[model samples]
Target: MDARPLLPSNEPDVASSPLAVRGLTVSYGEKPALFSVDATFPPAAMSAIVGPNGAGKSTLLKAALGIVPRLSGTVTVFGEPLARARSRIAYVPQRASVDWDFPARVMDVVLMGLYGELGFLGRVKAQHRARATDALDRVGMADFADRQIGQLSGGQQQRVFLARALVQDAALTLLDEPFAGVDAATERAIVAVLKTLKADEKAVVAVHHDLSTVPDTFDHVLLVNVRRMAEGPVATAFTAEALQATYGGRLAVAQLDRVAPR
Candidate 1:
């Protein structure tokens, strides 16, 4: 994990950012993948970056993390630019994007979370190893620590990757389809952790495709489609017109569920 002190200096100008994104844009060679988009994620809310395929949900998240080269605009985590503050952040890539075929064990994969800060090619220290194990236990992957990643079930793999991110213990996390291809139980577990992150005052942005769970899983929403069409409190922004614009009216009756009033 990043042992760095909480850099309160950059904490999102909560009043200004939530997740202030401006002039944001992206492209794939000659083709434009995203347009001049702008958005903000309200603080202390579970936000879902949602849209149909090709809506640029993934691209938006990637741009926020600097994983993709943005053509223009700025992405600020808290108040700090993501490029200048990676250690303060954590990312969980899409499961399908990983090499499940690789020869690493569950523990090894989680340990990579430390490789970013660990000495070049040096062995992982005891504390880092312990952190990995603790992360596994947190995600309920403790028993599978020694097992090959490919030998585990789809749910197990997802937890393992999350454990890796958990080890980072970042104040902000961005997950790309973390619930994809997982079972109900796994989905529940991941959602529970997401709640924990929010309870801990961390900001989380999840790229979600299943509109069914959007209501229950998020308090805020960012509707995308090669451009940011709308973003705000879930109840207000997750409207039918926004969905139509983002999905090109191609989405079936949106199966979005509603959160029970507190």
Candidate 2:
């Protein structure tokens, strides 16, 4: 697969980045998941966080969003603390992490995205419903809006979740393994939606596992292994040396060729 065109040579200013983390560290009890990790995801770009299993890719996203407790470090959204910028961010946890059995319809899940604006006691207005429907349409899940979320196929459910995130119209959208367990058609649909988001100048960051798609799917990448290993345009940071350092000996020669071909 060919790499996408690179973003402008001039990197975004640190403070202007959609998401920025400095000295971030996270631990569960005594086991450290990430240490002094720092990363900045630029606006209007698609970035992938890739590493081996247990390499802290998910931990980095969780810690940066304060979903998991952090041992140290600060996370900034548009140069401000998370609290001041919370409304501008939207997150989609891994599909495996969600309890799909919950008795909610697809539309109900999408509307939840507006909870911040519509107070708990507030009513859902016509405009709100319209936005929710539009989001579902964008992900090609509009027909399933009334269907029980648990009844949909894995790819369909993922599309519904993406629709939910779209309703928020967030400036920075964070997703955990969006392409996991999906069919080829679903993956193509999701990639198209992500590119539309980028075209609209929204920042898209996802924890991705399919190394083969990185070059064709993302504009920038962050290679991690409990710490920041390499990060920049895919052409520069996604090198054989960096991949070797990040994955160690876990990647087979053939797999390595697919990711960073000779």
Candidate 3:
């Protein structure tokens, strides 16, 4: 694994982190969702965002992408604001967030990824379609290209979303719960795709809940519970202490031992 250093709070080094959040605060009306959260995610590695439910794991990703409003702080992608770096980023939101009843076909959905570079009115051209087809093939969903998105299974739908992200060819990919509702086979396939992304030196950050697989699935982790409890290489940052802090004794000791093992 090509381990990268986490950036210090005072230093705003662009090259060190693919995604950087500093003093980030978010709220839903008066109630705070996240507070003073800070962390750096690097390239050439897969990082998992782990915490209890409602830990603002999804909010952190959204704020970084500007999909959600931030109460304060900044999110930098490859050293610049999100507007300037939009084309270089790809995001897969949680599966449950989508309207499965939408009338779009699989091909139509995957083609959406190109909208950043193609603009709203730009023609999608034959080559772009071919690229989308190739991406679908990579995710094992090529046969479903013409099928309605609502007709597919949960795992299949997840693959189509991944295919969309793959077609973007982005340097940084943020995924919220890729494994949610996915079968073992789909999970393995997704991990394989993530490995390919890391091999290409892309940064892949995912919100993951399955603690047992974290050690094998990612090289780094961001343990958060409203505020970031820990962030770094999995071996060092994913400790019993961090887990206890982030989970607040809700986690079983056996699980912690398996995850951190002293």
Q: What is the TM-score of each candidate against the true structure?
A: 0.88, 0.94, 0.94
Where model 2 places Cα greater than 4 Å from the true spot, the runs are: 1-12
Model 3 lDDT tens row, 1-262: 1112331233225556889998999999898888888888877889999999999999999999898999999888888887888789899999999999999999999999999889999998999999999999999999999999999999999999999999999999999999999999999999999999999999999999998999989998998888778787887787777787788878888888887855
The regions of model 1 sitting more than 4 angstroms off are 1-18, 253-262
For residues 104-177, write the lDDT of model 1, one tens digit per residue.
99988999888668856978889988999999988888988899999999899999999999998887788999
Model 3 CA lDDT for position 255: 86
Q: How many backbone clashes does candidate 3 have?
A: 0
Candidate 2 lDDT for residue 248:
74
- TM-score between model 2 and native: 0.94
Candidate 1 achieves a global lDDT of 0.79
Q: In order, how many clashes per candidate?
A: 2, 0, 0
